[model samples]
Target: MIFSEEILKWYRENKRQLPWRDTRDPYKVWISEIILQQTRVAQGMPYYQRFVAQYPTVSDMARAREEEVLKLWQGLGYYSRARNMHATAKTVVSKLNGKFPETYEGLLKLKGIGDYTASAIASFCFDELQPVVDGNVYRLLSRYFGIDLAINSTAGIKQFKELAKKVMSTTNIRDYNQGIMEFGAIQCAPRKPYCLHCPLNKSCVALATNRIAELPVKLKKSKVKLKHFNYLVVVDANGQTILEQRKGKGIWQNLYQFPLLETKEEMAAISLGQLKDLGLGDHPSILLYNERPMVHKLSHQHLYTKFWILRTDKVVAKAIPWEKLPDFPVPVLIADFIKRFKF
Candidate 1:
C-alpha cells in the first residue's frame, strides 16, 4: 500500500548497471524486454549486446534472414521468440515505415509485444506513466500487499495492474518501475529472500507475518508432459549430417532438426526399417554410432530424447542437400547436440 519513496530511493542506489537501462529508445527497450523474458540477466545480457550491435534498427532486423536471426539467437531457447521478433521487426519496417510505435496500444498490436512488454517500452522509452508488471513486480506486489490471489488468474492480473498504476511515480515513471523491479529481483527473491537486510522489511506484510513464500500465490502449474523422441542423426562419408526444416505449426516449426521418431516413452531399440518408414531413404545400411538418451526440459514439455548417430557409406538418393548443414537454423538443444557430436 505505502510503497513509494523508500522503494524509489533504494532502487536509485542499488539498480543493476545494465546496458539497456542506458538508452531510452523504444526499439532497444523492446529488444531488452523480449530477451529478458524466460531468460536470466546473466545469459540474456550478451545476447542483447550482440543483437543490438548487429541489428541497430528495426529495419536492420527486418532485412535480416530468418536463418541469420535464429543463428544469432542460437543458444537462447524459445525459438518462437526469435521468429516473432523477426516478424515484428518486418512489421515495424514495412507497415510502420521503419518507425517504432510509440503508444502502448500500438506496441501491443505488434506480433510479439504483450502488456508487460508494451508497458516496459512505453514507460522506459516514451516516459509514459504506465506500470510494468513483470514476474518480479508481481512477486514483490503479491508479498508486500499479502495478496492471496493466484497471480496467473485474470482477476489477479487486473488487481495487480491497478495497484501498480496507483503506486507508479507520475514524474519519473521509468526510474520508479525499474526500481521496484530491481528491488524484487535483488532483495525480495522467489526463494530464501534477503529480508533481514531488506529496507522494506519493516513494512512488508510477508516479513511481518512470516509468509514471504506463501504471499506470492500462484495457480498450480499443469504438469509438464514427457515426450519420447528418437533422433536419427544420419551422416555420410563427407561428414555432412542430415537435417530438415520442421514444417507446420508446432514447437520449432521453421527450425532444422534430424529425422525424428516419436513414441509414448523411451524404446529399448529402433530398427533401420523404422527410419525408412519415416521416408528417410531406401536400402538404409545405418550403423548406429551413438545411442544415448538426452533429457531436454521445455517450459511445458519434457523431451526424453534418444539420439542415434548413424553413419552411412554414401548419400541416399532421396536425401536433400546434406552439404548445407550449417545453413539452416536449429533449436539450441539440437544445435548443442550437433556441436558436441561434431555432426
Candidate 2:
C-alpha cells in the first residue's frame, strides 16, 4: 500500500538513532519498550541506561533483590511495572532458561508483556511481522485514516488493531513498525503536528478534512479520586524513624513509606489525638512538618499529603535509622519529602 510505502521511506531518513535501536539484542529492546511505555524518550533514556547498567542481563535481574530493583526504579512512577518486570525476569531466567520467547504469543506468557510489548519484542527482535500499537500508533492511524473511534473503547481498540495489522509492512517489518511509531511520535504528534512538512499529509484524511485536532477521539476519563494522607514521622530522641513497606496489589506495592493514616476528607487539624489510628497510644508531642499539604497527582488519583512529627521518649521497634532511610525504595512522594526534610 502507498501508506506503508511512504511511512517506511520517511522512517529511513528521519528515524532517530536511539540506543535501543542500535542493538539487535531483545534485552535492550524489552527494557527500552517498557521504559518508554509511560515515559517520553528523552526522560526515559537515562533511566534505561541506568537500569540496564545495574542489571546487565536477565540473570542479573533475576538474582538481584527486589528491593534493589525498586531502588533503581524509585523515581519512575508506576512502581508496579518494575515489580512486574522483575517477576517476569525471574520467570524468564528460571522457566525459559534465560532466553526470551521468540514469538509474539510466547512473549505474552511473561508478566507485563501485553499485546503492545509482545508485538514490539517479536517484530523488532524476532521479525514476527506484528505491529506495536500504543497511543502513538492510535493517533497516527486515527488521523491518517480518519478513524474517529474512541481509542480507549473496546470496539475502537479491536478495529485499530486490525487496521494496524492490515497496514503493517510485510517485508521490512522491523523498520515498518518503527517508522509508523516514530512518524506518530514526531510527525503526527498529538499537539500542533507539522502538517505542511508531514510526508503523509497529502494522503492523511484528517488533514484533508480539517479534522487533525479531532480525529483521534477519546472517551472522558474517570473522575480523579481525591485522597488524604497523613504521614507520621515518629522519632524517639534517637535519630531513628519507622518505615513500613506497602502491602497489596497496587502501584506502590513493596515500596516503603512512613506510617500513613488515610482519611476520607482532608483533616481540619491533625491532633495528637489522631495518633491512635497509627496504633500509637497518645504520643507525647506532635508537630506539623509542612503547614500546607502537598498534592501529588497520579493518573487517576490525587493525594493530598501532610507530614506530622511525633516525638516520644518511648522506643519504637523496627525503626530504621536516619542513615538507612535511603536504602529502602519509597514512593516518589516520600522520596521528595526525604530530600527536603532535615532528618
Q: What are the Cα lDDT values of the candidates?
A: 0.83, 0.88
Query: Which residue pairs overlap in candidate 1's backbone?
Result: none
Instruction: Tell me the alpha-carbon RMSD of every candidate.
Output: 2.3, 1.7
- Among all windows of ten consecutive residues in candidate 1, which has the lowest summed lDDT? 276-285
Question: For residues 262-281, could you state the per-residue lDDT of candidate 1 as single tens digits?
Answer: 89877777776677444444
Which lDDT value does model 1 have at 200? 82
lDDT tens string, model 2, 84-180? 8999989989999999999999999888889999999999999898988988999999998998989999999999999999988899999999889
In candidate 2, where is summed lDDT lowest over 10 consecutive residues?
275-284
State, as a TM-score between 0 and 1, how close model 1 is to the true structure.
Answer: 0.92
Clashing pairs in 2: none
TM-score of each: 0.92, 0.96
